[model samples]
Target: MNKKKWMRKGIALALSAVITAGIAVPPATAEANTGRIIGAIIGGAAAADEMNKQIKYYNTTEEGRQALFQELQEKYGVYYRWDLNSQLDRIFTNLTAAIGSMDATVYDRPYNYFINQQEGFNAFCTLGHNMSVNVGLYSYLSNEDEIAVVLAHEMGHGQKDHPAKGMKRSLGPTILANATGTVLGAIAANIWNGQGLTKPMEWEADNLAFEYISRSPYNPGATAAVWQRVIDLSGNNSANAFDIMSGAADHPSNSSRRDNYAKKLTEMSGGKVTVDDGDVYVNKKRLLTPAPAGGMSSAERAYFVMGNLAAAYRNGHAASAAYADGRTVMLGAQPIISCTDGDTSAAEIAALLNQIK
Candidate 1:
């Protein structure tokens, strides 16, 4: 499917015209409340966590998912029926079954394939293990191979236990406790919350999906194209420009993903696969520089890294500077957009960045 299709699948239910539903996740109690609104810095992160868990439970049972899927279909109408592909169903089922077999893993086979009855171009997996692919995905996709690549990506999320072992608590508080030795120690509060998986996790899932599907009948070349389409769809946002984490931990940016795929392909193929246009493809389209096949752009990569480093450093996160190289690079430039200049507190810096476009 095209980049739009991936977005639709990622947010499967809301866009379905037939499904007259609100973007609701379970609410938190006052005690655990972080006093943030959905999509807001504090509130959004918590919402993401809840979204992942609640949605997973919502789609856990066959009956539950089927009912929800049907509701979405009816609400969104036939315009979004792109995800009803039987081939995709089979492929996703097979891939999930194999990956779910791990000893330390938890698998809900029924939620393996997410299909929203809407025409929007999107698909995504939540941190709670929900996979939703919209009907519009078919229109954007060129073939089963391309579609397979996307499915593999969703599967990768589960493999990494991203849905479960997601972001670390809070570096700020953790650091304080470690430094003070129980003097003023408390777990750092989780700041952001959105149901979808983080960018790094998304990349991990994509790579795992590539590795898994590469073993199947899907075309290997199509794998590279999967990332190309993501970059193409992302536009100025860069493939990894936005936040991909589920309100926890760090994620690799789009550029990092792009470079990673190139490195991986080289390693996997024993230097056979090169990052050239003909070697990698996007949406059935050929890449100009091999685009690393399943990778993101350099500028886009810098955005997320710099953004996160700045946020962590401001939040008083211990290793913030170690990861702040992205921001450092930006600050190093003639213009000098320093993370330190923004705010000394990690939370304040995070909030400030959150306010940026």
Candidate 2:
């Protein structure tokens, strides 16, 4: 048999083995298992082939691409405006040109941009090189410069082949055998999960976005301003111990991300950029900054810490047990802490840190 057929047979055999063992698996688990089995059997070439198939499936035609985008928007409760001559479209065109200047390969691909009525500050690029910007994002941002920063960031994902790479990692060789609905569902979920970009990939996109932003008329400081707003909106700050580790799953923490943009802006502008306390400054003047806020409650801290510990366990880290102990103490103290202002004492914080150590 050919390797592709062998891979399919191996996946079938693995499923049969599970059934013979009387082990019941959920559809999602079964789907994941199928991917793993195919990955183990077929390796890289097959995975790449599956990825290419998916890319072609999504990128074949404008109508097909729009249908896929419509399905995704429906799945995510996103309402999008489709007018080609709208102000949002104009901005997208300008940003696309900026991105194309940074990487000419973008011109060779079919890229589409959409404006969505999502009331959250977000944007993402799909595997087909289609992009979306949220109206809520526009409401939050102050100008076209900030909008360009977000657009460039999404374009960076396409420029770096992140979506295709993510599809390869996610679908493996299972794409050759899975039902269209199942594969599309997985793709939608992956898009929701930071567009299938890992934490490091998010930073890489940020860096690439800054590179493009530097060459354009927009100030690179807009990048830091956006992240600072994210931090403020998320109620995460330098003073929050739990929030410090919050972005380990999909993206870097707000502080780290803001610092990254600040550093890059400074470098690109030859030390003309200034970053301080979630504010970006240019030429001795404040360019953008969010209002300050108090720290989170002890209940919030406990919940966040529990989440962190749970993630650590899920990732199979050795320190999960230690963090679990810390979670226990925090949860046990929740009643007392929740009634008060939810402040964790310094000694209590130190004890939790020691336990995690």
| TM-score of each model, paired residue for residue | 0.47, 0.56
Best candidate, TM-score:
2
lDDT, candidate 2, at 315: 34
Candidate 2 residues 216-306, lDDT tens each? 6554555665555556556545333222112225556676876676665455444543445533344455433322323332222222232
Model 1 regions lying over 4 Å from their true place: 1-84, 97-108, 112-114, 127-129, 159-196, 233-236, 239-255, 277-357
Q: Which run of 10 residues does model 2 get worst, by summed lDDT?
A: 331-340
Clashing pairs in 2: 298-342
Which tens-of-lDDT digit does each residue in 1-357 have in candidate 1? 885454334333321211113112223332123222112221223334433443454435565456655554454443323345666677776666555554225454435444665455555553334456666676666456667767676567655655434322221333322322111111111212322346655566767765665455544444554554555665323423332222323445444555565555445434422444332222222221211211334322222232223233323442222212333322111111223332233333333333331
lDDT of each: 0.41, 0.51
